[model samples]
Target: MAALTGLLFLGAMGTANAADGFQTSVPSAILVDYDTGSILFEKDADKRIAPATLAKVMMADVVFAQLRAGKIALDTPLVVSVNAWRRGGGPSGGAAMFAEVNKPAPVGELLAGALVVSGNDAAITLAEGLGGTESQFAQMMNAQAQAIGMTNSEFHNATGFADAGQVSSARDLATLAAHIIRTFPDYYPIFAKPNIEWNRIKQRNRNVMLDAGIGADGLQVGWLKDVGYHALVSAVQNGQRLVVATLSARSEKERVEETRKLLEWGFQSFRQRQIFAADKEVGRAQVFGGAQSSVGLAARGPVNLLTPRSGGERVSARVVYTGPLRAPVTKGAEVGRLEISRGPVKVLDVPLVTTEDVAVGSLMDRAIDGGLTLMGDSVRDLARRAMAKLHK
Candidate 1:
């Protein structure tokens, strides 16, 4: 709720459990609609837990960002450090790509190993290549997580191996998976690959949603002796895509079965619909000392989301900004945000831009608006203070 502060809210406010009707055995799980960034379902979605190999998705994303920015090419050769080899390779009793020590593994192979096989060696090599060391790379991971709004996650190492402090939530991992799909379509297919061969060792990918007949393309799976199993998976049905993250399952069967159930339920229950057109006015905002008292607002693109196929859900929309904006507003300039929700769950929070320009108003208009704003501010401030006291 702290994230909702400082912005105007024009939607209904209340506290209700998200995805209340559905139940599952996994301790932390989330279902997200890929297109509209909606939370279709969630249970303990934000409770921090060790994600184990699921953290490789974050490591992979960092490398993807670097590749997209032209910082490194797929063909660039990365050295496999002894530290990476001994700790993340075959000797560690963890998943490994088995790259030879002192040999240079190409960036492309490392990406595939990390994503397809969940190879710690491949992940560590990429971390060292991109950030010079695993510890430093963890800092970069934390930075990227914050940039992308994975607020509850923190990374202590690139391999998801560290003190208990290395942690992420199911919601954050799902966000990471969607971020990969949306930002790196070229590399995203690596997750869907069935297997990868390195050092003459071939390992079948653990994420077998494709074989499960659930429309899963690629993602990850993990197990820790005491921490249980976790998976971050995505699936598509009839061209609609959804991401599901399940953490701390009791066994391999539960991890797969529970995730498949959530994905199928989401696909069956929702249909995508365009609620607002790209150029049409979404709402309006007051403009002080301008040619007009208010300016029309529109989204940069069409607003679409997975609405219940049966319809008639209690949906609400909001416009957020600190206004009345003073003078000379330009058309297409961003001024606020539009947030839409169903029941108490957030759906979309998109940018809002001015629909038309408004030039500066006359001196008399400015004076009047200033006086009115002063009075309004005082009244709003008093009300805000009272609300703060109540909150305390």
Candidate 2:
């Protein structure tokens, strides 16, 4: 009875903690640090709910990855098959891009259709262009999601505009968006295109945050009856970028406003600090006989530290080397790590290494050192024997 009562009390406490942390405004929501990939906030982020139009982000990922790899060029032409036209076209027949089957469209305009107009036809066209089929393209998307560490995501189809069991979580979407921005920065600008004119058809962007004062750019908006409304929004301000995603919104305007509010709250509440710069010499190590007596150490990139903006919070840094470094090390060899902390909570871990090499001494130096060591050992042995006799 006593143990059961204790368990009940603990369960109640857990529920209270979750209640405080969970954002009830949306069914699922997540906010993250784009620079460091740190999750600042999350609520029911892994419930495996419907992804709505937000699924297009994965499609965008597939297309952009292929584009970056030189597997396909922007002007590459893709033939619109009957399958893509029928399934991917606008709302009446799958939100079709009004693309004609058996007609050729450039991969770039099709991407604009998929991203800007949310045309199902464009998605299927790009998928077929890259994966040879919509189903196969979805497989590629799932594979890419897994590779980028999105554990709670699954792609049932190429376009996330509509389909049952095609689901992802808010946290996963945020993670995916951040990965796209980081991995395919070259093509990320496409997401920010406010309007695209193709075949004399002009479509405007639906993401209001793009024009909002928050400096948001490059993300997708999604909606469907089953999933309500959803969007993955990202913004960069003063060199700091953040990604936020929400699900089950009541309306498009609500999702946009809430996303803006959430982003503002996050940016106002927290700040990213550069704890250490990569490859910047943190310190120096002694060299044996090189032209320089010592070598420098630093990380490869800036070690970013995210902290609350209230100030007075303690942030510490420590470096870990790759053991005792050998001589003749290059100027940019990675050597160690710098661990940053706020009290007991770790904030950042940066690598530390040698900036230059210390060449080993010459043959003459080695010979003299060997002779001195031999003489010293012989003298020590004789002294030990003398001491033993004296003790005896």
> Best by lDDT, which number?
1
- lDDT measured at residue 130 in model 1 versus the true structure, 0 to 100: 86
Instruction: Please write out the lDDT profile of model 1 over residues 3-88, one tens digit for every residue.
Output: 22133333322212344466878999999889887777888998999878888889888888999999999999999999999998
Q: Show where candidate 2 strays beyond 4 Å.
A: 1-24, 90-94, 161-164, 274-302, 311-392
Error of 2 at 52 (Å): 1.9
Please give the lDDT score at residue 332 for candidate 2. Answer: 70
lDDT of 2 by residue, 61-160 (tens): 9888888889889999999888787777643455546777889999888887887777888888888888877788889989999998788888887677
Q: In model 2, what is the error at residue 299, expressed in angstroms?
A: 6.8
